[model samples]
Target: MAPGKLVLATHNPGKVVELAELLGPHGLEVVSAGSLGLPEPDETETTFIGNARLKALAAATASGLPAISDDSGLCVDGLGGAPGIYSARWAGPGKDFAVAMARVNDELGDKSRTAHFICALCVAWPDGHSEVVEGRVDGTLVWPPRGGNGFGYDPMFLMDGQAQTYGEMTRAEKEADNHRARAFRQLVALLPARPA
Candidate 1:
């Protein structure tokens, strides 16, 4: 796994930036599938790892290069981990989290606000060989979403024992110990070591 070109199998601008940042220190060149004009495949998988594997393999096969992909979502305890795989769908076609967050609140009513953000990272090679891992950070929901730094449900997620929401924290603060970073830490072993 020498440092080299890698395709990120996602069209999400925020994810592309975040993942690129994470992959930077490894000396790997990162490019989004969307940037490469690769089509997004339907995520028919029921689990995060499954979907991540699907996207990674698709990109790897199409681009004939190593590819990475992640499937992440906010799972609420009260909602029985609903919006789990359908978090994006909950945002509708426009990918509006404001509406999605509102829906979460409405459907939750007075139920527990406990929630967790989970991420599954997958790396696939052109031959279809792959490795996947998952990570999560627990937190609680807050109304009147705060901050505007991160995307999706960040504004509504307050990590355990933290004063600021993920959206309120600086990029360094948010990336320091979030779900994606946690997953990346585990996936790092599969990557080339940082250049000396």
Candidate 2:
């Protein structure tokens, strides 16, 4: 794996912190694109992996350093996978997830609530070499939302057979089996080993 500083290609503070925590133990000095003043690129790609790769490569090329990016969203089966790639956009310009959650519940009235969260992670080097991986977790949507811990649609997502929503679980609990962590586990094999 390439060493030295790595750019986390995201402007979302939640994602930046979450990804930084995952990358920290691997001995990489992590910096976020937002922190570096890198403009957020339009996610024109239709697939999660494609968007992840595009963002990663864009940041890597712009900063002349290796970069990592993730494109993730809730895919509700009832919505015909709507708000999948457009998850963030559903939150509107204010990024208000409450509104997004409400919209989901409103649109999904009396429909099957089966859903899944998918995450696609990409690592790109300044030379444009990149690797991407994806992970997912299935769950059901809940009404009125729940918990106050996690960000985005976490409050309304109850994992299969789990009592608590992602928003109700502690950081350690969420990271243990969430889609993002699942993707990170795969990406870890390609990363440099932890510092001795």
Candidate 3:
């Protein structure tokens, strides 16, 4: 086949940029599902795999193009994985990640403060081919949040073994050590090599 041109199922540009970096040197043409006017999946699935696949398959089938999608969330140890799939809508629509983060801080309030960021990456091909990978970066949650870099849970997540929180870290630092990037690297490694 021709060099792969992937359509990321999500409309989020931040994720689109991150995905491009993770995809690497093959220089594959990356497109967004929003460009195709595709509606985002309902995300009705209970698990990350289900949600990620829903988006990837929908975009791939709609555009007749290979597609990539991610379903990621912050899981709090005390909450027993609550707000997992609902992380995006925890504070209701219009996606107030800031509010959501605050809510988490409030809910956990004075307990064993452990948390993790989980990422599910799904790739779907027009011919119905597909793949899914998962990655997690475990850490403890902090109160009042910190830093000003990352969006959504970044301010509170003290990445494992690191002194600075995710929000405190730069974009490059986040990508190099983030859950999404780890899972993406696995998926990218699986991409077929281009013809010379």
**Each model's lDDT:** 0.93, 0.91, 0.83
Clashing pairs for model 2 are none
- Name the lDDT value of residue 158 in candidate 1: 100
Q: lDDT tens digits, residues 1-196, model 3? A: 2366878899877788888777655566888888878998788888998899989999988998888899999899898887788887896777777789888878887767888899999988877778899999999988878999877778889988999999999999999979998898787777564231
Superior by lDDT: candidate 2 or candidate 3: 2
Please report the candidate that would top lDDT against the real structure.
Answer: 1
Model 3 lDDT at residue 158 = 96
**Candidate 2 minimal-lDDT segment of 10 residues:** 187-196
**Model 2, runs deviating above 4 Å:** 190-196
For candidate 1, what's the RMSD? 2.4
Better candidate number, 1 or 2, judged by TM-score: 1
Arranged by TM-score, best first: 1, 2, 3
- Candidates ranked by lDDT: 1, 2, 3
Candidate 1: pairs in clash: none
Lowest summed lDDT across 10 adjacent residues in model 1 is found at 187-196
Estimate, for each residue in 101-130, the C-alpha lDDT of model 2 and write its tens digit. 999999999888999999999998887788
Q: Mind giving the per-residue lDDT tens digits that candidate 1 earns over 1-196?
A: 5588999999999999999999998778999999999999999999999999999999999999899999999999999998898999999999999999999999999999999999999999988888898989999999989999999999999999899999899989999999999999999976543221
Worst 10 residues of 3 by lDDT: 187-196
